[model samples]
Structure formats: C-alpha cells, structure tokens
Target: MAPSPPPPAASDAQYAQQFLNTVLSQRGPSALPYAEDVKWLIRNHLVALIDAFPSLRPRVALFNHKDGRAAHLLQADGTIPITHAGAVYNLPAVLWLPEPYPRAPPLVFLSPTPDMLIKPHHPLVDCSGLVAGAPYLRSWVFPSSNLLDLARSLSHLFGLDPPLFTRSNPPNPLPAAPSSSMLPAPSPRAPSEVVYSPRPYRFPASPQLAARPPPTEDPAEVFRRNAIAKLVDTAYAEAAALRATREAEANALFAVQAELRGRGEWVDIGVRKIAEEMEALECRLQDVTMATDVIKAWVTENHKGAADADDAEAEGAIQPADVLSRQMLDCTAADLALEDAIYALDKAVQEGSVPFDGYLRSMRALAREQFFQRVLCTKVNSAQQQAHVTRMAARAPSHYAS
Candidate 1:
C-alpha cells in the first residue's frame, strides 16, 4: 500500500489570515524577518508567480545570508517545466527571496533527491546547489524584476544545461530523503505524478557517516553513460512524433487524390455519352430532308384554287391556322435554331468544356444546314406572293373590260 497524502491547506480566507498573522509577527527577535512594506511586495510577487506557474507553492525556510546571518525567509519551491533537446522535463528547484528582494536578486538552488545526482561543472549551479551568473540575476533591475521572470529565466538556462541527472545505478538500501514542510505530503489515493504544491517542502541529504561503503564505478562514468542514454531516448521520441505527423499528411493527400480520380472518371463518361448521342443524331439526316420536302409540297398545293385543291388532305392532324404562315415560319425557325446551336458550341469551346476540334466540326455541319433551309424558305415565299398578286390583277381588269 502507498503512503497516505497530507491534509489540505486552509481556505483562501483562512490562508490570507495565516499569511497576515505570520508577516505581522514582529514582536520579538525571532519574529518574522521581513519589514511590513517588504512583506506586501513579497506577497504580491509570490501571488503573481503562482498565477503563472501553479506548480510552485510558497513557504518559509531558514535562509543562510552571505554575512553568516540565518533568517526565516519566504521560499517558492516546486518543479518548473524545461524543454531540452525537443523534450520537456520537470526540474525540481527552489526559489529563495531575501528580505531585501526586488532591491536584490532572489537566490536559486537545485533540490536534488537521493536517487538523483548533481551535475558537475555546470556553468550556472555549484556543488552546494547554489545558482549564480544567470542573465536575469546578474542584470536584475530593482522595482521591476519579479519572481515570475526570475523563474522563467532560470528555467531557460537550466534547459540548456540541466543541473541534475538521475543515477544509472542507485545504491541499494538507500536512506529516505529527510522530510521537510517544503514538499506536500503524498495522499494514498494520489497518483505518482509531480504535483506543484501551492506550498511544498525541503529535503535532507544523506547524513554524514564515517564508515560508508564505496561505489562500484566512478561517479563521472556513471553520469556520462546516463546522459548518453537519455539523449538517445529523447532523439527517438522526437523522430517518432515527426513520423506520425508526416503519415497523417500523406493520408490526407491520398484521400483528395481518390476524390479527384472519381470526378475525372465521371467527366470522361459524360463526354463519351454526349458524343454517342451526336453520332445517332447525324444518322437521322436523310429522314429530316424527306420531311422538309413533304412540307414544301403541302404548302404549294394549299395555294391552288378551290377546283384544283386536294380533297384528300390528311385527316385528324394539326394544320396551320391564320395565326401565322406555318411553312415559311417553321423553315426560318429551324434555320435560326441551327445558328443558335452553333453559337452554343462556340461558347462551349471558349469555356473549354468541349474540345476545339469537335466544336469546329459540329459548328460547320450546323451552319451548312441553316444556309440550305434559309434558301429553300425564300424560294417558296416568293412564289406564293407572286401567285397572289397575279390573281388580284387579272380580276381587277374583268369588270372594266366587259
């Protein structure tokens, strides 16, 4: 069974009350070390920092000043997210704010556990876990620099050179790290995930012992091999992520390609069907010419006198009434229809819906038919009019000549 978690903290109002009480406790030598005004600034900065990185929690710790002064100070402790070699890893660290903070840079330290080892020769951190030379710390401007920016800068620097690494082979029967109030107590139901406690804790390193056993390998070799293995794992993970992205893109392209191919096939089928219809229409040309000749003959017979008119005109079929002269009108209409059809073909060519060669051939055939229809209509109309005038003139002279 897992160790049970610690109890939750006070409510917002209660926490505020607790903070006020702690900061205002200035009655004795062991009272809160920060001034009244400095306490307000610290609260504001800390509140702002937590808002940005909720993983860090605020607490009090014994701060060892450079002048050998040990004063109780506010500490922000937890892991910060760092991206290194295309991988994100949590870096457990602590941020210590001195009483003169904002006027002075805050202190930073790597909080390594027993299973972890401090990296050697890091440009920013030392063996004692103290951090220095950070760009933000060295150039900190008073009244403007805050804990949030400090944490962000340190996170960036640490990512480039991680200050801690896990041991490849930890010693057996390890002693537990000393418990401090700086870390949140684990809950029995809590999952094994890094929790950014609003307030977390501190730890104790292995106690100094006179007769400790030696390690099997040099510390340097063990750390070096661990570093190499971690790098290999990070590279593999990044490559796998890239490969997944590429495969998704390829699948999308193939789907588009399939849809386009289906559309192309449908277009090809439509064109072939239109071409077959055109061929069938061309085969009916002889029948259309015969019908035209029959219409012309019927018109010529209708103009004859009553004695010469045919008594056997077709029965129960629709015939032209006085609404219009049907023979000439119909012939002109067919000619105009062919002309309009050729115009449509011209548009189809311009739109590139039909091939240029097919457009040209179809237009020529239609234009020839229109020309012949117009000529035949003109001849029939002229004859009908002349015959009407001749009859009228002959009747006009008979009354006077008698």
Candidate 2:
C-alpha cells in the first residue's frame, strides 16, 4: 500500500493567525458597545500572549453558549503532559475570557481524559479538573495581568506537583533498565507514550463547574472568615451600645419631667398661701386707715373746742394744743405703718415672689385708704382754720373796743 501523506499543518496555523487578526481589528473604530480604551487593553494582552507562547498560538472565539456574548481562548497545543503512577498523560487546558477582557481574570479549566483521574491536592486544580481559586486569580487587576503570565504560572505548577494519576492505581517507583549488548533484547515501551486513549479536544459548553468551594482548612481562608465574623460581631455590639444610650437618655428625660411637675405643684401651693396672707394684710391696712381718719376728725373737733373755750375764757374747758398735736402724730404713725405694708406688698409682686393678682388686690386696698386719709386730713385742716379765724376776729374786735 502507498504511504499516506502527512496531515495538512497549515490549517491550525491559518486558524490561529486569523483569530489573532480578528482580535487586533476589534480595537479599530467599530460600533461595539465596549470603550476604546478597554478594547485597546484587550488587544495589548492578546499581543503579549502571542509573543510569550508562540507554540500554543492562542486564538479568540465568541462563546455563544451563555446568555451574553463573551470571548474564549482556544489553543491546540495548550496541554500539560505529566508522568504519574508510572504512566504519562496529557491534561488538556482551556482559558476563558470574561466579557470585559483585561478587567477580569480569565477562567482556566483542565479537561482530563476519561481514563485519567485527578486528586484534590493541587492548589489551583479542582476536583472537576478546573484550575481556579488561586490568590493571583482572585485579586486580578486590569492591565496588570495577561494570558501569558497565567499560562506560564499554570505550566510551572505542574512541575512542582502534578495531580494526574491512573484510576484505582497507586504510584510505584520504576526500576532501572539494564543495557545488554551480547543477546537479542526485547523491545520496551517508550517512556513518553501516553497510557490513555486520545479524544477530540473541545472547550466546556458551560463555564459552570462542580468544583468544591474554597477549602476552610487553609489557614489563610480560616483567618479571613474569622476576621469577617469578628467585624460583624463588633458592629452588633456598637449598635447595642447606641440603643442602650438612647434608652438612658429617654429615662433621664422622664425623670426631669417628673421633677418639674413636682416643683410646679409646690409653687402653686406657695402662691396660694402668699395670696391668703396678702388678703389678710390688705384688710388690716384698711382698718388702720379707717382708725387714722377717725382719730384725725376727733383731734380737729377737740382743737376747735379748745380754741372756743380759750376765746370765751372758760378755764376748765380749755385744753392745750399739745394734746391735739400728740393725737395728730399718732395718726401720722398709723398712716406710715399702712404705707410700709403697701411697699412690702409691691416689692413682693415686682420680684415675682408672690402672685401678681393677689398683690394687686392688696395695692388697690392701700390706694383707697390713702385717698380717704388725704380727704379726712383736708377737712380737718379746714375746720381748724375756720375756728382760728373766728377766735382771732373776736380778739381783734375786743382789742379795738378797748
């Protein structure tokens, strides 16, 4: 039979080149909703990936399986080959780009062959053969990360500890093969031979994976979770403290109101007592004024009689003007006492020490007494002047006859 011609190698190279060209052209003036700066950043990252991994030749394609349009990285040669459990296997990897490229980190997946088994010891590799949960990927920064750096990191990780293994098999150390030249040697299997069946490479239809959540066994993860819990507890404590303070303030306000009510009641009682005292003082002042008026009239009448007796030369009926002066003085003293009482009442009202209405009533009483006293004094003085005139006229006529 004739030898079969080698498969066309230019097909993959053409596809990769075309995909790169499409990504580069996306930065041009187009009616895409993305900003020009974002497109430019994505282009730069793609260029970096191409320069770093020329053998892989990463290509971009529209991911139509999801609800929104997104880009995915497709590479034919992007596989991690590892030797585990005395056998070699190729772990196919796929990189997925987020909708806003360069702003978010790409998701990586390691789709193993059906025959290949994966362990959970790998830091980035999940049980579902998904490579995620790395601190670098979690804290991705825009324009700072590129596909090349992530690919290189994942590739280097395999060298440290590859988790690929054969199903239901334990790893056994291989014995050294001795070289013999004298006898015919049996053929040995190639060390680089893949132990598993090959299958067509394809990206995951859906990005969702059955990978477990980040393990809490990790010390860093535990510390982060505890810190968050502590913060929540602290916030609750602060809120409780604020509530207590508000309650205390409300209680204090109630206490102050109660005290003010008590004080107001006491002030009312004091005002009532002061009003009663003022009424009594007003009555006393009126009595004193009336007595003063009576005394003044009696003094004027007695003085008139004394003047008449002296004019008629009746020795027994004549009394000295000194007695009338003494009576007037007593009347004046009574009036002074009434004025003092009025002054004290007015001061108390002005000072707000007593109720104004009660004090005003007392003042009215004193005013009436003052008016009556003034009228009585005026009438008594007029009577004395008339009696004096009569006595002087009698004396003058007698002197003229002499």
Candidate 3:
C-alpha cells in the first residue's frame, strides 16, 4: 500500500488567520475580513488592524463570498461587497514566508478561475486589462498586503451586484426568441365554478411504481448529423482554396520583382561602359591640344630663322624646301585640330551618346576645310620662297664673279 498520505496540512481557517494577521500588521485598522472568518477564525489580524489604522473602523467590514466573489462580508447583513474591476472575487490569499522571511514575494491567485480568456479572440468586458489564462492566478507581496485590500481594488473596475443585476434592478421581462415551434405547447386548464367541491387527494393503496424506459435516438437525427459534417467539410475546403490563391498572388509579385532587378542591372552596366568611353575620348583630345601647341612653337622658330637668313643674304632668301618646312610646321596646328575633330566624331558615333547628326556633319566639315586651307597656305608660301631664292642666286654670282 502507498505510504499513508502525510497528515493534512493546516486547515483553511489557519490560512485565513495567517492572511488576516499579515494584513493587520501592515494596514492595522484599515484591514477587513469576511464575516465567516471574523466569527469562526477570530485571529489577532483584525484586532491588530483596528488598533493600528483607526480610520478603517467605519469603512471596513467582514463580508460573505458565497453569492459572488468577495473577500469580505459586512457583519451587519453578511452581504459580500462586490469589487469594482475584474469581477472575480474568490481570490485565495495566504501568508507568505521566504526561506528567510521578508525576502521573496508571496504567490496569490483566485481559487477556481478558468483560462478561457487565453483564447485568441477573447472578448473584453470593461476597461481593466485583466485576462483569463492558464492556471489563472495573480501574485502579491505579503509583507505589504492581504486579500481584502486586493478585493477592494479589483471591485472598482468590473464589480457586479450580488444578483448581478445593475444597482439591484433586475430585468423584468426576460428576453425570449420568437417561437419557431421549438418548444412544447403548454397544456390548457379546464374552467371550474363549483363552490363546495371536495379537493380529492388520491393515495396509492400499495404505492407500486413502474420503471420507465430510457429514451431512444431517432434515425432522422443521424442523417442530420451527417449533413452537418458535410457542410463543415465544404467550409474547410473553401478556406484552403482561398489560402492557395493568396500564396499564388504572393509568388507572382516576387517574380515581377526579380525581373525588374535583372533589367536594372543591365541598365547599370551599359551606363558604366558609356562613361568609360567618354573619359577616354576626353584624354585623347588633351593629347591633340598639346601636340598643336608644340607645332606652333616649332613654326615660330622656323619663321624667325628664315627671316634672319634673308636679311644677311640681302636679295637672297632661304630655299623653297626650307620655306615649305616652316609653313608645314605653322599649319600643323590646323592639322592637329582637324585630327581632334575626326576623333571626336568617331567617339561620338561609337558611343551613340551625341544624338545630333547635324552637329556631327558640321564638325567634320569644319575640320576638313581648316586642314585643307592650312595645306594650301603652306604650298603658296613654298612657291613664293622658290622665286625669291632663284632671283637671289642669280644676283649673288657677280660678287664672286663665278
């Protein structure tokens, strides 16, 4: 046999007395206990409270908790006072002590509460945020409190009168649904007018009672149950279909986003390539400008040297070949510029960045004309120098007499 169960722990009366004592020590005269506890379990808790917080003497009272959830009952009528909030009143409180007293807090909660409120769609009744949940208990520190005070605080939020009718006014005509042949009809009574009729009372001679048979289920009910099952199955199917539709729509949106990302990447790559080509063209243009400047300096030197040589020879001048070289150097500036324009046209065409065909044609024509004119000017200068050289040579022979 299982070991005899340990002797029962302290009784409810003991627990009640301990709780009262704890409260009285803290609140003194402000403390109150249920009338049953006051008469049956008169511990020092109430007396101590009366002496400590004298003000509570008038307001505090022991009340009953049978009709509704109340921690204290009024001594005058044994009426349990309803709390203001979280209509639950059967809060089970006990004296708490730590491994060493006054360390950890006390554990407290209502005795028979359900956890229905933990459901996802639980409805709210009033302003207080109290909720029903698993095991359904609230904790309170005891060196600081007791059950009666807790009841008073909760009563302020969602309290209902003992009858649960607002302010003792009960609803007169109970709400009823319109008759749909769901209830049995009441039997009609026969009218009576006899004045001295004996009220017959029937007494069974031997009081023999017959046993009645248990009721049986009808075949129609089984069919109705089957119909309900089919309806539920159809509803579940519809819900599953709706879920599938939503999932498909989400997938379609993701696919669209992926396509857009791919297009964006291609656009970025194209833009980068165009930028690189433009930079290269700019660098080539800089080189052309520097070459032009170098050619200009060479032209200046050649022109000065030829002019000095002409002065020293009097009627003679530099040779045609020398003049041609000087002119070519001077014209190199135009050649360099024409070369730059050709390169610009080719770059613009390849990149397709410069959209104007008219602009391209005008630039090309300008380069061609400038370069061709520079060449013509060099030729003319060469011809003039040749004539001067021939004349100078003919005259110079007299001085040497050769």
RMSD of each: 23.4, 25.3, 26.3
**Residues 225-269, model 2: lDDT tens digits:** 557545544664565566658768999999999999999999999
Best by lDDT: 1
Per-residue CA lDDT of model 1 for 108-171, tens digit only, reads 8776665677789876777767787565676565577789888887776676667777666566
Q: Order of candidates by lDDT, top first?
A: 1, 2, 3
**Candidate 3 at 167: error in angstroms?**
60
Give the candidates in order of TM-score, highest first: 1, 2, 3
TM-score of every model versus the real structure = 0.40, 0.33, 0.21
- Residue by residue across 148-171, what tens digits does model 3's lDDT show? 443343333223211122112323
What is the lDDT for 38 in model 2? 71
| Over 4 Å off, model 2 | 1-18, 23-35, 60-77, 80-90, 167-402
Query: What is each predicted model's overall lDDT from 0 to 1?
Result: 0.66, 0.55, 0.40
| Best model number under TM-score | 1
* Residue 37 error, candidate 3, Å: 69
Name the weakest run of 10 consecutive residues (lDDT summed) in model 1: 181-190
